[model samples]
Target: MGNAVISSDKWHPVLDRCLTISGEEEEEAFQLLENLASFMLPYEISASPLLQQMWYIIDNTKYDGNDKRLKALSVLTELSMGSADKMQLLIDSNKNARQVLALLLCRGKFDVRQQVLVILRNMLINLPSSIPFLVERQTVIGVSDLLTVMHPDTVILALEAMKAILENGGSPMTPENNEPSFSLLAEEASVHSRLDFLVSSPNEHVALLAMEILHEYIDPNDDDIILPDDLIDLTLHPLS
Candidate 1:
């Protein structure tokens, strides 16, 4: 069915139905959209409208955070992370992935949020072009908020996103014409202070990621940069 010769015109009704779907119909509608994504990717159909519908379906809140909505979003997230071509199309169409990300980051249930994070991490890891779009979307604030959460997994996801931005020269310090405009937001959010507390996180990955970011971005002479003894010891004595 993914190979069907469906024109872009045909997808409009599907989007309309998805936007207005309810109850069991919602799940089937999402599944159909997911199936159509294969064809959509190969053709030049506008993906943003479909993405917008998915966001609405998820945001209705009338759904009361049901599994059906999550299922649809999971598929949408997967589609966003599908490939550079697909993601580029979404970007070109000016589809904002950040709204969907914000919903998952701020309010999604634990498992759903984790899935969203995985999708985000993969998107950043694979698509460097997405950095400006994300940074412009003020994603750093959301990533910083994740650091305050008690869950180490979420913290790791946040770290990975930051790392991607930093490594890709998406940092505030990056010298480029199109740098994201809200560099001050990171400082205002006190992201460094939150990361300082995570330096000694019980999770090794979390601790390491925190240290890596601090090492690169935070001034070594700054009074606020506190290194955990374990992290210091591990750094001083490698292979121990």
Candidate 2:
């Protein structure tokens, strides 16, 4: 295919055009964008005026219902983290982007949200021990639920996210925000509490999921990870 001349002044039209295109053409469009992600291709799509317009459009739209825009956000997220400048663009736009991310998280769009969770957690995990903005400051349920579900790839991502919070949990949390800290007991208690709710669940998957999270983390291969006393007691004494 010939070059799909990227816009210089406005991406909204091109963005809309992409959505209107047939599946093949749209995939081609996405390839063009994703290709820009490679350092070798090097057209600097992030600086494009058209790309800026697309970002602005995504910020204002009801993307929960927009598959095309969701597709684009997933792609852009991957590219924007390739460098400090790009990563900062993502961080700077956190307010505008965070809402959409939260929606994806709440809605459980794992195909996209799972990847994003991994990316975000990995990025923030070792960055001098603090979150970048208000978006990061809020208590998040996404990780907790994922832990309960034992989402295969996501369990590790959730644990990575909680790592910092757990470390910081040593001090008494203000009454309203009683998040568990890294103390092995607190962490185990938090996991156990979530699991307790699932034990009576009709969904065998749910019980099994809880088992996975607990068993894997408390495995002999694992070190210093606590298993809540109740969970251990339950494990040691299964009621037939």
Candidate 3:
């Protein structure tokens, strides 16, 4: 019983099949992907092509079911956990990184959504240049999906991302052209209304976090906060 050698030549075919197969073969495909990720450690496998395929699979909605997308996201999260530099390089290489992230936030299941949130959190914290791009995407894709979730811990995660973006100066959303993007995102996501919901959350930590975002959104000197009339009404009559 000798240890098996894991190499790109061996794993690439498996990953390639995972990308191409669908429907009746989904479970088999997912298993291959699972094995690839497991063997990725202690073997120094090149993940570039694998990552590209995963993103490709994610973008292709035709074969989106059967937990394939979830498997892809899981592998990505695992890869990212090992190296922040790798994560940054992934973003730099993939022009659609923001688009993929936004789509995942809107479509992924609970675990998938949480992993995407962590990616966003890390990118914002470690790569300041990524702020504007991520902010625009998240605002448009709607953080409300996570913010308005039932789980208190998940709610805290979403709120934490908002706090990071704003604290890192995402509130102003520089370069004037980007300003309207955030406004539309805020309006479409009904962020102000969601903040109202979170402020009264049963979890005191959640409530405080929401309050901080709300405060930053309304900070007197900041010109970017757009409060829709409905948001005003909700604030005025929280019980109504």
Select the stronger candidate by lDDT from 2 and 3.
3
Index of the highest-lDDT prediction = 1
| Candidate 2 residue-wise lDDT, 55-93, digit = tens | 653454554455555556655556444554555555454
Can you rank all candidates by lDDT, best first? 1, 3, 2
Tens digit of per-residue lDDT, candidate 3, span 1-240: 112534545556667777667776867766665555544543243443766777776677764554677777666655444454555555655677776787778886677777677667656655666677656645444467788778887777677666556556544344335555454456566776787788778887787667667776535354544433333211110000
Over 4 Å off, model 1: 5-14, 42-49, 55-72, 95-120, 170-184, 220-240
Assess candidate 3 and give its lDDT. Answer: 0.61
Off by over 4 Å in 2: 1-16, 38-46, 50-62, 126-130, 134-139, 164-240
TM-score of each: 0.67, 0.56, 0.68
Tens digit of per-residue lDDT, candidate 1, span 1-240: 633444445556766876566778877767777766645653444533666566666666765567756766666565665667776654454354556565666567766666666666666777777766655334566677778888876787777776676667544334235534343455666777877888878888788778877777655576656655565332211000
Global local distance difference test of model 1: 0.62
Worst 10 residues of 3 by lDDT: 231-240
